[model samples]
Target chain A: MRYGGDNRGRLLIIVLLVTSLFLITLDLRGVQVIDGLRTGTQTALTPVQKAGSWLVSPFRNFLSDVTHLGRTRNQMEKLTAENEKLRLTLQNRKTADAQLKQLKGVLNLAGTAGYEVVNAKVISQGSTTSFTQTITIDAGTSSGVRANMTVLSGYGLVGVVKYAYRDSALVQLASDPAFKIGARIAGTQQIGILSGQGTRKGVLQLLDNTTQVRKGDVLLARGSQNGRPFVPGVPIGEVTSVDNSPGAVTQTADVKFYTNFSTLGVVAVVVSGSSADPRDSLVPPKPRPTPLPTVTIYATPGAVEPTPTPTATK
Target chain B: MSLRRFFYSFPIFFTVFLLQEAVVTQMRLPAGGINLLLVVALIWAALSTPEIGALTGFGAGLMMDVSQTSPGPMGHWTLVLIIACYAIAFLGYGDDNIRGNPINIIFLVTIGVVAAQTVFLLLGMMLGQQVGSVSNIAFLLAGSAFWTAIISPLILKVISFFHANIFGMRSQL
Candidate 1:
């Protein structure tokens, strides 16, 4: 009996050791067994995920409502201030009229680029403690949102679409570690690669060591194709700091993103188009002329004569 | 009977896995964020049989490894989670008390965080990646661990509710 028990224990130990060793080897080889398991897991959990997301939709809506309320308040305050300024400026009628004409001419000269604005909504977010800062938007192939398309809010650039599905797409923010954008300093035109470093921070790598990039300088997309895909001069971020390492060939700077990602609300997906064109969807619509009311004179001869007689008596 | 139980638990395990992938990852706190799935796994292990707990940990960890951006070996998380589950189980809390015990939860979280960081450090060293400053790693680990510890109770409560209401287990809580 004792011998039999000892044999069983040894067998159990052997089995455990063998299984662990097998798992380790499988792991080292980068085997797809885990991937298969993950797919299987995802498939099985899709319904639950959908349900959970639906249940949480109200919370997201509430958060969005709060965000929009704050934004509306800010916009109201801004518009009020602008209204006062415009009222003051209205005192100089001739100068204002000339400025308006010049602006209108410039707008008329600009032509439309190819793309149009199609609206999209955010659907889901990344999962993990490591901060998968990507957002999945509802716009997909059918919506004309393609991979590498730029997504922007009124504030500034939100992110670039990394992967697009038939009904949804994932956007990797400029703050994600994997994102890289070619940018130039707005003032000095120093070209550099803006790479995300996993945190909410990004580093700008300049080509020339003596590049004249300063704090508060704006960064814009470089080599924009007629400003269609990415509208040229759309503010990306402001340079926060510059770093020059001794003996290093190039200089680098940290950028403070214009978009307040922590409180992201509504964003507009700018389709490809020429920035010089007056057909920008973001531009306010032209004011329509008020139509004059037409009156038909019914010449009732008797009524007209009586009215003239009454007026003469008065 | 063991296989049947595993098969039954598969759906719950899969849901936790997907939640970790889809929702929990987006919650960013300073240093690092809380890994709610890890906390759930620890709690589940404590409330169940040790063998099953270890297996679940291994399975979930393997899924995490695949889902993560890390290009390293797949079973790295699996090994770490399994070891953590086993260690937590051996700490010898009674099944009934383990569910609501704050001390137990904290202990398990500490072990899990330590195990995870240690494994990652070792893997990084083996893979010839820059380990960065030791102080930085320590700071990150400590901060993340505290964050995870603080949130573990809430996660535990939610998982326990699910286990009881959905999975039909009678919980001590």
Candidate 2:
């Protein structure tokens, strides 16, 4: 009877090993059946994952708070003072913008670029077993999200949707080593391939080396011909440093992606783009000194030019 | 164990997988974070016969392969985990010193996770997947092993209590 256990196990292992080998072979060959299996699996587990995320969020936050206890306390103190000031301001009957900063910023960014977007919440982060950096979002095919579609935050490009199910989608984060995108220097035609190095920064290898890529130059997605993956003029990152190597046909530059994938809360999926490319229209405005506040109690319209509404709305 | 006895493990493994993906993965940890599912699966396998151990590994591997976050071809984790967990089962089988001791179980899990990941990396590279730099892989494995060891005691007690309830014993399969 004891020996029976070992024999049964050995036989089962052989069967399973063969099955796994078969599956791997077909998957590596890009078989449609395997893809279907993957999709089916994703579809089945997405709901469970979403529900688990909901249940796990409080615990996650507590752990996060514990890790950043000192910072949390400091923020608490700062927010308490800010709360007092906001309370006094609220007494004046002025309406406060209560929307999520990321959501509002994304909406404003889409408005600037004229891309119709479906806003979505980040449901969960990467899988524990997977080597890739990925995230699951609450939007999917029902919201017109398609595979290979561009996903972005208010700050800039987040990633591309690798798989889109009915109600949820898998996003390959921009920080994954497998992530790659075509980028162009802002205000110039110098295009290149930008690939992630598994960090906040990416490596941009300019296709044309003759055009001296300078430091601090901004990069934008060149956009696929049909825009299946990306839309033109979405800011990608800024060049931090350039590789200066001899006998090289291409020069690489280090760029820090504009969007911080770690802290992503609210993002938007571009269902469809505008008639125009909205070239350079979505570049995050440079930080400027806040205009001095004038205490003109009765001053209303045109008293002082408040930061000219970032762009003239359509 | 009979098929009925094994049925109890399916939901346990499933819940562990969900917790690993949903709660554990979301945490910003130093070396990628803990593989709660892997640790639990190994410990379960260690406490059981080789047959049950292989089954647990296969089931857990399928869950991992189906994950949306996995980038490699399907069945990679399955292939690696089955072998690793099967080996662990054999190592711990018929051995009281390894099964009854928390420290021994800790080492078993730590070694199991590291060995599985190492095999995964070699296989991934063979299949042309970009696994990352060698140093990065080393750091990730070390961190995973370190954290799993640190938490194995708590996991050991929890699993012990749960298994005692289900199997009617703590240290015997």
Candidate 3:
């Protein structure tokens, strides 16, 4: 009897293993049955996972803080005064900066590489070991965010939206290998394709061999035909290194992106608009139109003008 | 095969799973995070019958597959973990010394983790997924195995406590 039980147990293991393999094969074959099962499982579990994650966030933060207590304390000691000073300074500077940016936006409206901007906040980050760099944002279709829309930060281009859920969207970072953006060397017409390097950085390839690109040259997105994925003139990154040899037919350059994908916070989704150069916003606004001088004129009974008014002429 | 044992052991399994996903993954330790689920599987295989071990592994693997940040096809991890747990359970079958000894437990856990990881990576490669280069993958596997082994002693204590209190099992393991 014991022997029979042992045999049955072994048989069960074999069956489970084989069944799992069969399922894996079916899934690999693009079977909709397995896909549906997997999606249902995910959709059903996502809420629970979200709630668990939310509940654990404070614990995670506390744990992180505890782990870095010593370093944090030392840094705090050093930065306390600086923080206080900077807080006051930044408070004042923030208002000025807002005013400045707003004024610049208005002046550059004509030059705006026109794209409607919808702001979003990052909800959560993907796992560190995830195959692709992606993030979930709090804004979605309700906020005019849609798949393939370009996300941007104050510094530069961020990524493209991959999936737009009801109240959230998944943004595939520019560092993802699957992502590609048409880009150009800033200040020049030289165009290249910006492709992710699978690392934090990116690469601009397919530059004309004759085009000379120096390190530190900025890169800007080359808007698509419809300008949905990338609005033209949005800063992408800066050239870190140029790989052009004397006999090479094509050139490539490594790009150091201005926007840090890992620490993304508030971002703007390019919803719709005419593509305008973001760089134009940095230019000082044209002096406010000089207010037309108030002129007072009186007509005599014979409709004679004030011909004796030498002061008016002055 | 005792329903009571299975029912009692389940909460322990669920707790470990939550720890693996919620806490361990968030640690960001220098050597990368330890696979707590792998350690749990090792403990389950050591203490339980092959059938039970396989079931536990399958359940854990399925949860992992579904909850992965970038999910792949389901059942890949399930197969890997089942095979790993069953093999380990078979190796230590009816051997109280092997099952109860810390050294044996550590060795089994290490081997089980390496086996599961290698199979998973190979399967991923077969499916045209670019798991990193072999050398890097091997390094990661070794590192994770070592970490799992390092924490196995603590995990084993927790498992033993649950086994004694919840299941009322007097088995040595």
lDDT of each: 0.58, 0.78, 0.66
In candidate 1, position A72 carries an lDDT of 61
Q: Is candidate 1 or candidate 3 better by TM-score?
A: 3
Global local distance difference test of model 1: 0.58
Query: What is the TM-score of each predicted model, taking all chains together?
Result: 0.62, 0.84, 0.68
Q: Report the Cα lDDT for residue A98, model 2.
A: 22
Better of 2 and 3 by TM-score: 2
**Interface CA root-mean-square deviation for model 2:** 2.8
- What RMSD does model 1 have? 14.1
Candidate that scores best on lDDT: 2
- Give model 2's DockQ, 2 decimals: 0.50
Question: Could you tally the backbone clashes for each prediction?
Answer: 6, 0, 9
The all-Cα superposition gives candidate 3 an RMSD in Å to the true structure of: 12.6
User: What's every prediction's RMSD, in angstroms?
Assistant: 14.1, 7.6, 12.6
lDDT of 3 by residue, A1-314 (tens): 11124677777777888888887888888889776664454344444445654565545544554666786686446545686678546545643564355434433432355556777666555543324456666677777788888887766678888767656677888876557898877667689898875555787886577778989887877777677777677777778898877777778888888776654546778887463456433222334665554555566787656644323221
Between candidates 1 and 3, which one is better according to lDDT?
3
Error of 3 at A97 (Å): 15
- What stretches of model 1 exceed 4 Å from their correct place? A1-54, A57-118, A223-234, A268-314, B17-33, B47-50, B62-80, B90-102, B114-147, B155-173
Indicate the TM-score of model 3: 0.68
Best candidate according to TM-score: 2
Over the stretch A173-196, how does candidate 2's per-residue lDDT look in tens digits?
A: 887778889999887769999998
Error of 2 at A221 (Å): 0.4
